[model samples]
Target: MDIHRFFPPHEGISLSDLSGLCGAELADPSQVDRKVTGIGSLSQAGEGEVTFAVSAKNLPDLAKCRAAAVFVTEKMAEHVPSDVAALIVAAPQSAFARAAAILVPDALKPLSFTSDTGISGAATIDPSARLEDGVVVEANAVIAAGVEIGAGSVIAAGAAIGPGTRIGRDCHIGHAATVQHALLGNNVVIHPGARIGQDGFGYVPGPRGLEKVPQIGRVIIQDQVEIGSGTTIDRGALDDTVIGEGTKIDNLVQIAHNVRIGRHCVIVAQVGIAGSATLGNGVMIGGAAGINGHVTIGDGAQIAALSGVAGDVPPGVRWGGQPARPMRGFLQDAAAANARAFGKKERKRGGED
Candidate 1:
């Protein structure tokens, strides 16, 4: 992450003030006045930088860490180097995050590209469209008929909002992105080049050939959902495809029609979900995973990278493999296969001897 891109250079703050803000207790009172200018990782932090150590894995590097201040849990306090000031907290990473937000307010806020004119004159907007106060439409964007955009939303340059789409407040339709047949909630972000509410891949075998199924359902996205660049979400065939609140989907992900993803799900890049798949709350899908159609992944289930989930996954389990099974079972099978291969090689070597 480039710190300069997300945050401006912050004026140094006193260790005493920073510790108080993060609800962490300073280990050495004499170092309270030490100045902290920036934040960095344990390996990269230098003088005047504040870093964090969350577990024992980081303890080995504490002796070499050159940061002026460090955040640590109570148990890790003993490992802190004498020269470095330790700020103890219940959760080191969480406390460090809070400190970053305080020091860099711009990092938490949305990007602003507001021009002299509130709405761009070059943009093409239908007369019937309703745009609320503080909505900014950039150059060459199109707002189709019957579209309603809420307050503080931004339609970036070259973006297109299809007819009858309802967008809520504080939403951002990124540059060159397209949205159609969708109802979006507040605080939603559709990144650049994202394709939303497109027709699903539905077909029927007929006498003429493959018959196309008309997809008329909407894509309903709840609040705080962030769709990554180049991602495509197909509109449902009959029922709405719903993405619950706070779900973070990575780039190049393909979500098929009628797929319902629950709240707070983390879907990594290149993940493809087939139609009618249901994922319960807090589910995590690793990169390049394929979820079969009509399957249900229970709450808190974790799908490993490159996994092919062909059946329903139980709640609170870790699954992996081409045909995903329990993590433990998958590991055992791999170990057995490796052993058999090694034995066969040894027998061939003995026969040659």
Candidate 2:
């Protein structure tokens, strides 16, 4: 797909300048004059563009690469086409990412939907609401009473801010997202359609049937957190639902009330973290995983995709499967199941031979 319509290529940068910007060692400083204006994948990169390769698997693409330069590891540098300048780095992809950020800075964050700066006139802001300088409230956005928005924050079109919520500096509240009973820290990015501070699933047996529990707690989102589009984070039952600094939550994730996620935790798409569950620092929960309520996952634990975590997990362990056992035990069960299913076929083949 042509992305130029949305994210245009940069003007130009010389090879030496790009190397320093991306922390890469230029193999041949003489080629410093070479300029690149765009970035693409190995196979698709053309003249005056940049790309990267990390392993021998990319050799076929690297052989025919037409980019002005290529980020590569020391081992892969030799295989790069002679026409392309090689930029060596320990982490080639990360170097390329830094280059992308430098070249396509706009792609890092969402641009103003209405293009109007400093509070659009069409936005409806309460008289009591406090907006600092450089806050951009786009068309049809609603700011409730007592809302406090810091400088350099953008409230996109149709987004709603509830009463008394505080948004910190440099935050982006995307189109149509709703924030209520929450306090957000600096550099938070709430993508389009994300539902924050909604009531959680809590009920109790009553005389009539089930009685709904009043969700009155707030959501505390720390700095540099990016919540994906369509994710829903429920308000706490009694305590604040806290998302730590730099935690990334993917699309369609359901974070229930009172959940505490530690710094830098990554919760992938469709993951459901039940109420009051606590995740320690650097924990990575894979796509579609279901972490049970009240369970504590230790620091650096990795839960595989489609796993059902019902109990506490120790630090730095990898787990997978239903009821989520240690990876080794899960693999053993899989191996036994495989043997059972294939044993009859093996016996039949032996008789035929």
Candidate 3:
């Protein structure tokens, strides 16, 4: 595993430097100089590789890892063998994530743009706006200033892009997918009729029934983010709604203001995330799941379909039911209720308890 493949030569960071930069206490500095070809899970890592032990449960597998270096937490450092080099860090997962970036190849260049192509003349484009080859901006597509588009990305008719909306190469913005005053990373697919950066659901109860509030914030969508059809992501009342990298939002999902969705989160169809709700990384929200305002769903949490989440969810837990509860608890409750109903029916028929 020559380290050159993992870390870009342009980055100027060698495997030897990773130890110091990540606050890792190396077991064998000699191995630190060894080149790493790739990154993988502890169970699958090969020689000249680097992997991370994210939790105590993974320590047993880490012991037998064939990789040159293993990122382990302070608590698990004692378990790491002296023979295998260890990159001891407080947060092994974070360190491993940083290492993965060094290994993965950068995005490829955009396709070539043909001189004679369909482009909206009425569109206001900045000098820095990167229009890739074969990219089409339909009639009345408002490409605002400083918008950079990757190759083969298409903007449909009447679609609007706010300032600094960076669309990745090869992505598509569907018909009338309105994005304003926001920042978007690469490989983002925004479906038709999706309204991004709209006003949030905010109203003050005054002498009248309700008074509307002004929404003045923006949305920040990271790389590889996909927004489905008819989904509406509202701008913050005062702040912003940020969708982390690699998050996939399904069709007809409603995301309110100031919502912070972590990386790799999956939001299924018809899911409604209320204002100020925060979801941690790797959270999976099922179809028709309704998250109440101000809820905090921890990392790796799973919300079942049609569940109404009103409270904070702990990390690595699965929840379900109308008012969301632990999946096991919800199942047990349903079983017990059915049993009680059966017992009542037996008693009514003159059977003994």
Q: TM-scores of all models?
A: 0.91, 0.96, 0.61
Q: Candidate 1, overall lDDT?
A: 0.93
Task: Name the best candidate (by TM-score).
Answer: 2
- The segments of candidate 2 whose C-alpha lies over 4 angstroms from its true place after superposition are 345-353
Q: Please write out the lDDT profile of model 2 over residues 1-353, one tens digit for every residue.
A: 77556878889999899999898998888899998888889998888889999888899999999888999999999998888999999999999999989878898887768888877899999999999999999999999999999999999999999999999999999999999999999999999999999899999999999999999999999999999999999999999999999999999999999999999999999999999999999999999999999999999999999999999999999999999999999999989999988998899999999
lDDT of 3 by residue, 1-353 (tens): 74345334333345677677666778666766666656767888776667888787887797787876788877887777666578888888888877776665442222222222458686556666778777788766778778878776778766788777777766767777888767777778887789998788888999978999998888888888989889999988888899999999989999999999999999999999999999999999999999999999999999999999989999999999989999999999989999999998988889543
The model with the greater TM-score, 1 or 2, is: 2
Model 2 pairs whose backbones collide: none
Please count the clashing residue pairs in each candidate, in the order shown.
0, 0, 7
Among residues 3 or more apart in sequence or in different chains, the pairs in candidate 1 whose N, CA or C atoms overlap within 3 Å are: none
Model 1 C-alpha lDDT per residue in residues 1-353, reported as the tens digit of each score:
76456566569999999999999999999999999978889988888888899998998888788999999998999889899999999999999998888766665544544462468998999999999999999988999999999998999888999999999999989888999999999999998889999999999999999999999999999999999999999999999999999999999999999999999999999999999999999999999999999999999999999999999999999999989999999989989999999999999999999
Q: Give candidates' CA RMSD values in order.
A: 2.5, 1.7, 9.5
- How big is the positional error of residue 261 in model 3, measured in Å on the Cα after superposition? 0.4
C-alpha positional error of residue 233 in candidate 1 after TM-score superposition, expressed in Å:
1.0
What residue runs in model 3 are displaced by over 4 Å at the alpha carbon? 1-117, 120-134, 144-151, 162-166, 342-353
By TM-score, rank the candidates, best first.
2, 1, 3
The true-structure Cα RMSD of candidate 1 reads: 2.5
